[model samples]
Structures are given as C-alpha cells and as structure tokens.
Target: MKDIIILMFRLMVCIFEIWMLFGFYNNFLKNKPRKSRNNIFIILVFALIIFAINSIDNTILNLICVPVVYFVLAIVAFNGNVFKKLFGTLIGTIVILGTELIIVAVLNITSKELIESSMVNEPSAFVLTIIVKMVTFIVFEIIKQFSSKESEMMDGKTFCLYILTPLSCLGIMFSVVFCRIDFTENSLAKSVLIIFFFCMLIGNAAIFYGYNRYAKILVEKEKNRRTVMEQKMELESYKKVNVANDRYITLLHDTNHHIKTVYSLLKKDKKDDAMNMLSKLFDKYEKAEMIEYSGNTILNTILSDYKEKSSKENIECDIFVERGFNIEYVDEIDLVAMLSNLLSNSYEAAAKSDMKKIRIQMFMQNDGSFSVIKIENSYTSMIVEEDSVLKTTKQNKEFHGLGIKSVQQIAEKYNGWLSSTWSDNVFKSVLILENSMC
Candidate 1:
C-alpha cells in the first residue's frame, strides 16, 4: 500500500509537470489546436496510460519510459514535423531532469539528515519531492518568461545580478542548512568555493545576455536589409506602372490626328481603306496597354505588374479582384509589402511548374470590417519545414522567406489569420485581415 501511494504521488507529479511545460510552451510560442482532430480521444487515453505506470521503480526503466511518454505526447499535442517534436521533447525532459538534480543537490547538502530520514520514510520523501518539484517549476517559469521578453538594452552587469539573485538565495539556504561538510576541518575553504560558484553563475548569465543581444541585433539588421530590398522592388514596379499609364496618355493625345486621317480617307471615297486604317490603330492601342483596375492604387499596381510578368513567363495568371475595391484603413506600406510578397511567391512557383498557372482572388467582407486575399499556384519543389519554420532553397537561408514571414507578422499584428495548404501539387495560401489594425 505504501509503494502504491508513492507511485500515485509520482504519477501526480508527472501530470503537473507535463501540464506546466505545455502551459509555458503555449504562452511562449502561442500554439493553437489543430482543426478536425479525430484522434483526440485516443491521444488522451494513451496519455492516461502513460501516467499510469509508476510502479516499475527501476531507474533505467523509468528514464527510458519518461522520454518515450513525452515524445508521444509531443506528437499528439504539438504541430510540427517528427524531428521537431522529438527534439523539443528530448531537450525539455533534460532541462526538467537537470532541475530535479539541482533540487536534490540542494536537499542533500542542506537538510542532509532530513533527506536521509525521508529516504527511509516514503511519505516524507513524497512530500519533500512534491515541494521541490513545485519550487523548480516556478523557477523555470520565471526564467522562461524573463528570457523570452528580456530587453536587448539591459545592462549586462546589472542583468546578470538580477538573474543570479534567486540562485544565490537557493545557495544561501544550502549554506545555512550546512550539514554534509565537516565544519571544523575546511569550512573556510568550502565557503570560498560557494562564493566562487555564485560568481561563476554570473558568467553563465553573461553568456546568455551576450548571445541574446547579438541575436537581436542580427535580426534587426536582416529585417532592415529585406525591407530595403522590398522597397526598391516596389519603386521599380511603380516606375513601370507610371511608364505604362504615360504611354496610354500619349496614345490618347494623338487620337484626334489618327481619327482625322481616317476621316480624310473616307472623304476620298475610300471607305475600305479608312476602316482598315482605323482597325490597325486600334490594334496598336490595345497592344500598348491592357489593364484591369482596383481603386486601391497599391493593389492595382502589384496586380498589373504580376499580370505582365505572367505573360512573359508563359504562365496564365487569373486575377478576380472586386471592381472599385478600395482599402482605406490598411497601412499602404504593409498592403504593398503583403501583396508584393504573395504575388512574387505565386509567380516564382508557377513559372517553375509544368502547369504554369496562378490564381488570385481578393474581396472585401460584406460587413465591411475585414478583407481576404486567396492565392493558389502550381509548385513542383518540395518544402521541408521544421517546427513550423520554413526551409528555403536559396543559398542565403537568412534572406529567403522574409516575404512570407513579414506577411505573417502583419497578419498577427492585426489579430488576423494566415493559413496555407499544399494538396494535389498545388499550394494555396490565404490571408484574412481586419480593417484599421488599431
């Protein structure tokens, strides 16, 4: 009965720990549930069975089993590739086990006799273990939240002090409850080593802070570079649009002369010649410019640019945009960036595929509060993603995928959704955004 009780306590601990880990994950990564989950009930039953077996008290067996349990749960609970699920679960389990070891070290050094007595008394051990688990969980939660949101501008020296403070408190408790070390023999030496460890803890903090600062700087620089490149592309597109519209204006300016020539031919009793001349002029005018417009300048410009591009690439681009469609509240820069990216991706993929076709549809919501853009294109290349992170085929992995990522960020900023699907050798993506991203 006592063994059974211990096992039950351990099982409870496992459940709490799993729940807490996932809670932190959800908060940090903003994970959401998958739609159309038919196997959810089966997954829960498997989870129940995983947490059910704590009776096999062998360390080797338990170590092997814990990883398998979490790995399986990761597959059911997480949305990503198998490699991502297994890797995340494996690292998380190590962190948790490392924390447990830290707590054990503290307990053994501080309340050596109490822990020793607890080893013999199962109830006391269970209680002490529960207490330690809670403490460790809380500490980890604080660390994760802090690290994720830490400011790059934080002073390294002061920040390191802030982090190690809790660690120092934990160490101090161990020192005050000192029992394992022989006090008379080398108490002074042991005290110095404890101080040294505390100092080195700051070194650990420094490494984290330095890496964070470097990564933040690197990301900001990369984004700035991509933004410049995108803006330059936009400028070139606007130039082409301006040139096309100018040519159409020139054709209209010369229309009267062309019409007068046809009229003179008709007056000379050459009606067939006049009609043939008029038809030739009309052909030139149509060849010079063929256009479809949405009232929104940004949307119209990008669609026109891509339409011409599709023709050149021998890809049929079908665009169905609501007539007189206008966007008043969406940021012009953001709109341009998003549309440019979506169209560029479609054009690139469609140009490479055998089908050589791209389809785009955009419409305003009837309620006038939102809009949706849907794009589908042919894709022949395989996509490999890990943990929802897109892998690029380009030489510079850092530079590629910035377009889609920027669009995603824009969507998220507006509390909107960006969804993508690949089926039947076609890739379809949709962006739904609210008006006035205030």
Candidate 2:
C-alpha cells in the first residue's frame, strides 16, 4: 500500500509539472491563450504518455519517448514549423532537466545519507518533491509572462530578461546543492516544510514582477488610445470649420450675381419673366444650403467634400442619403475616417476611368439596428486583384492601393463589416455597421 501511494504521488507531480509547462508554452510562447478544447485534450494525453514512460527501464525507449514528447510540444509552440519547434522544445527540455538535476545534487551534498533514507516511503519526502516542482513551475511561468511583455519594448530588456531568468534558476539550484546542511536529527517533515517556505518566497517575488510589468503595459496602451481619440476630434473640428467658411463665402458671392440678374430683368420691362427666374434661382440656392444633416455631421462633410472634388474632375456624382441616422453606434472620428477613405477611393477611381461616373447610397435600416453604405463606380478595368487589393495603374499609383485596407480596418474597429466585388466592369463596395443608437 505504501509503495502504491508513492507511485501515485510521483505520477501526480509529473502530471502537474507537465500541465504547467504546456500551459505556459501555449500561452506565452505561442501567444495563443484561447485554444480549442481539442488542443487541451491533446496536451493532456501527451503529458500522460510522458509520465507513463518513467515506469519503463529500457534506455532506448526512454531516449525515443523524450524526443517524441518534446517534438509534439514543439509542434504546438511553433505552429508546426518542425525545425524551429524541435529546437525550442529541445532547449526548454534541457533547461528543465538541468534544473531538476541540480536540485537532486544539492539535496545529496547537504544530507547524502539522510536524503537517501528520506526517499524510502516517507510521505514528507513526497510532499517536498511536490513543493519543489510547484515552485519551479510558478517561477518559469512568471518568467514567461514578463518576457512576453518585454518583447514589445524597443530596447532589448525582454531579451536580456529571458536570458538571465533561466540562468538565475540554474544558479539557485546549484547553490542549494553546494551548501551542505547537517540534517542530524531533523524530521523529514520539518525539512520539507523549510524548503517549501523558501520556494514560496521565490514564487511570490516572480508574481510581483509579472504583475508590475503587465500593469505598465495596460497603462501605456490606454494612453495611446486616448491620444488617438484626441487627434481625431481635432481633425473633425477643423473639417467642420473649413466647410462652414466655404459655405458662407459661396453664399455671399452668389448674392451679388442674383442682384445683378434681377436688375437687368427689370430694365428690360420683362417683369413676369424676371420674377419667374428669380424664384427658381432662389429655390436652387436654398436647396444647396440644406445638405447638412444633424445626426452625422462628419459623414455629411465627407460626402460634400468628395462631391465637390468629383464635380471638378467632370465625374458625375450621384448620392442619396437618408436623414436622421443614429450616430450613437459609432464615434464621429471613426465614422469620418471610414467614409473619407471609401469616398476618396471611389472618386479617384472614377476620375481615372473613361466613363467617369460614381454613385453613392447610404441609409439607416427601419429597425435602427444597422447602417448600410454602398459605393459603385464605372471603371475601365477591374479594381481589385485576386488578393482583394485595389489594382494599381500607371496613371493613378498614388491612391489606388490603400483605400480598401483603410476601410477594412475602420470597419473592424467599429465591429462592422465591409465587402467589395467587381462585375460587369463596375466596382462596388458595401459596408455594414451595427447601429449603437438602438
């Protein structure tokens, strides 16, 4: 019964160690924390196979088993890049095995006879083994966490940490081996307790370091997001001011022409014709001023700006927009960025074509759950390549390639969707965004 218990304890310790190592590799090394359930099951099976191998005494079997397990783990880490995966797993396994050997050596030097005796069916000895393995696992996990964050830095701090952390673990193990402790009358339980406490101290230190680094990363990312938001707001304000100024200037200039036309008609004594012409011109001018919509001012400005540019290039522009869209679902800046990229691309494409025509349609659904925007233009050739990027032509290299990628990024940021296709010599792009207003 005592022998059975010892075997069971060893099995459990091995399984736990494997679990921690594989979990760390999957999370920190692969940078994929959210794997499927199938992957977890596969790792567990592999760990069990490794644990079972200790029962086998055949040297050939042990040699083959170790490499196979490491190979499987490497495949998981390197996403099936056999050479890199094998190399990394081999290095990691060597470090782990080396640390274990050092631990055994230290215990031997400190209390050779006592350690050998303690290994014989003592529950306390098994507990000490568990404590050591757990502590080592935690230390390695901490190193992995810190190393991941450090990798993002411009400097080589993370790389230095990675190199130093494993070395430090090795040094600690060696120190414990070299320092002899006279365990003359100390109970195995008491000795195990002391080692457990020391291991806990090391684990705690690692936890502190990992948390501090993780928190710093969070703070930096938050600051960057805020700065981006501020810049976007400033750009939107500038666009509004420019649009308002241009509208005012255009109105002032048109008023003088209106007055001159009225005066000439009256002098010709064609009073009825002059009144009719004045009424039509006044209605047309008023309609021009009524383009702005309150709910989505940024989108309105973008459309208006593109419309003016298209008119200058002699590209016929057709736009139909439904009023009173719910702006609650998207920030003004993101909305502006999305529309600006899409419309600018359309205008540029249309300008390059022989037909030179573009059509834009935007509307909010009746359910108020989504907003749809579509832009289509006549093109001399297909716009997108097989990879779904705008194909560049010698005449329009500057603006042809980036529009689709920009729109896709904006859509992803807002939890929206974008798709484009070409058919019948016409290019069409469609965007759908969840209406946060609902």
Candidate 3:
C-alpha cells in the first residue's frame, strides 16, 4: 500500500511537470489555434510519454528522449520557426534539469543518507520530488508573466535587463543554499531554509511583474508620441488645403470680371494676350482642383498632396478609385497618416527607379464586406528586408522605417492589416479593412 501511494505521488509529479512544460511553450512561443479537446489530448500524450521515460531511471536516456518528445510537441502545437521552438524546448529542459539538481544538491547537503534512499517507496523522496515540482511551477509562472501575449517581441537589451534580476536572485539562492549549515537535527532551521527559497522565488516573480508593467508604460508612451505626430501632419495638410480653398473662393468671386476682360481682349484682336490670360486662369484653377480625388475630405487632401509631390519627382501615378467610395471606419487623422505614409514610401521608391511609376487602386470587395486598397510601384534595385519586414534602403536609416510600421498600426486598429511584396523590381502593398463601407 505504501509503494502504491508513492507511485501515485510520483505519477502526479510527472504529470505536473509535463503540464508546466506545455504552459512554458505556450507562453514562450505563439501557439496555434487548437481546440481545447485536442490541446488536452496532446498534453495527456506528452505526460504519458515523459512519465514512461522517467520510469526508466536513466538520466542519459531521460534527457535524450524527453527533450525530443517536447521538441516534436512544440512543432505540432506552436506557430514559430524551428529555431524558436528549439529554443523554447531547450529552456524547458534546462529548467527541468536545473530544478531537479538544485533539489538533490540541497537535500544531500542536509541529509545524504535520506537522499540515498530509493526514490520509489521512500516518503522523503516523495517530499523531495514535490518540492522540486513546486519550485518548477513557480519558475514557470514567473516566465508566463514576463512574456506577454500582445507583444512577444522583446529586444535584446530589454531581455538582458529582464534576466538580470532573476540571475541575481538565483546566485544569492545558490550561495545561501550551498553554505555550510548542518540542519540534520534542526527541523526549525530546515523549515526556515525552505521558506527562504520560496521567498526568493516570490521575489523573482515580483520583479518580473514590475518589468512587465514598465514595458507596457513604454509602449503607451510610444503610441502617444505617434498619435501626436499624426495629428501634427494632419493639421499641416489641412492648412494647405484651406489655403487652396481660399484662393478658389477668390477666383470664383472674380470670375465675371475675368471673363469680361478676356472677351474685351478678344474684341480688340489681342488674341495672344487673351490666350495668355486664359492660360493663367487655367493654371490657378488646376491648383485649386488638386484636392478632389476621394469622397472623404481628409483622404482627398492627403492624396492631392502626395500627387503633387510625386509629380515634382517626375513619377507617373496611375490612381483609380471607385466612384462614391469612402473610408467610413477609420478616423480622419488615422486616414491621413496611413495613406500619406503609404504614398510617401511609394513615391520615394519609385522616384529612384528607372520606370518611375506608382499605381493605387481602391475598391470594395465583390461581397462588399471588405475594402481593398492596393498600391504598386517600380524599383530599380532589390529591397532590403529584416526579420520579414521591409527595411528602408535610404542612407539615413534613423527615421525611415516607422512609416511602414505606422501604416500597419492604423490598419490593425481598424480590424485591418497591411501586407507588402516585391518581385522583379515591382513592389506591391495591399491593405485590407473589414466593414469599410463605400
């Protein structure tokens, strides 16, 4: 009966360890969209396999087979590259081995004879396993809090900063754990030692929780900065449009007088002078007509501004918009920012290319449920890309890449996405928005 009870405890520990590994993988890597039943099945299968491997009582075999099983499970259940999955598996394996080693090392120091007893039927061995599993669970929970679901993209510097606290705590823990302190007959001292270890674990978790909060504040600050910049740009564009409107109103007020003067010139046989007058009038009207591309006022202004800029660079623009189409879901400032950034990128890229052409097409999908905006431009050279993101090839790299990122943020803000592709010197960008009515 005692043997059976010990077996049950060991089995429970094995299953708990396996569950922790799965939790680690899910938190460390992006998980696939799996049904709960399927997820539970995968966990059960992994638990059974790991339990069987542990039953062999061979460290080498357990290490080799256990990580292999986890690696396979990660591949099946996660959505990341092979290297990322391998890295997650490696971390799990290390935690498993490290915690078990810490447990045995500490227990042996306290009582070598108690540590030497067979692990299967010894109550002390069962307690040791429980302690190890408890520590592992705490470590796993700390990691889960550190890696957030919204943004898993931690920079190297931040990752280093995040890891420093835990490493320091672990060092202190080990120094104290390995100190020469005879606790064989001192039950109170041993209990205090265990409580101290738990305190360290709790401290590490608290530190990481603080780090996550600080990271979120940094993210919010960046967003606010971006929002302010967008508003500034929108204000500038609207000022230009307002100036053009003023000129247009003045021109309309003087229309009758201008027409009479032209007719008078024609009557006097000053045909050349009349033609010049008409030409000048036409130039003024053309400038005033620039802001008439889209039904949305903000979009029209942005398109007009970019169109004029592109024309200065001798870049041909082939823009097509479906009649009466409007972007109803996005905010005015966001529309200006997103469309302006996209066109600015296209203009810069196309201006340097031999073809010197840009194309934009906006229309609702066939089902009328989605709005599609496609932009294509010509480029002479290969585009630079980093981590699957298109990087700016300009000489000044400091402030060039945020335009694409801004567009993506706005797209995602409105249940949309931005995608870009390039093939044979023609770069393409497609933006899709849900429920953007015409």
Per-model TM-score, in order, reads 0.59, 0.45, 0.64
User: How big is the positional error of residue 395 in model 2, measured in Å on the Cα after superposition?
Assistant: 10
Q: Positional deviation of 197 in candidate 3, in angstroms?
A: 3.4
Error of 1 at 129 (Å): 23
> What digit string (tens of lDDT, one per residue) describes model 2 on residues 46-94?
7678778867767678767876787676565435345656665675576
Clashes of each: 0, 2, 0
Candidate 1 local accuracy as lDDT?
A: 0.67
Alpha-carbon lDDT, every model: 0.67, 0.64, 0.76
Ranking by lDDT: 3, 1, 2
Best lDDT goes to which candidate? 3
The TM-score measured for candidate 2 stands at 0.45
Sorted by TM-score (best first), the order is 3, 1, 2
Write the residue-wise lDDT of candidate 1 on 150-269 in tens digits: 333345565565556545544543454343333335545544543444344334445544755686797789778867876886687678678778878889998989999988998999
Q: Which stretches of candidate 2 lie over 4 Å from their true place?
A: 1-237, 249-295, 382-402
Worst window of 10 by summed lDDT in candidate 3 = 115-124
lDDT comparing candidate 2 with the true structure: 0.64
Q: Give the Cα error of residue 241 in candidate 2, in Å.
A: 5.0
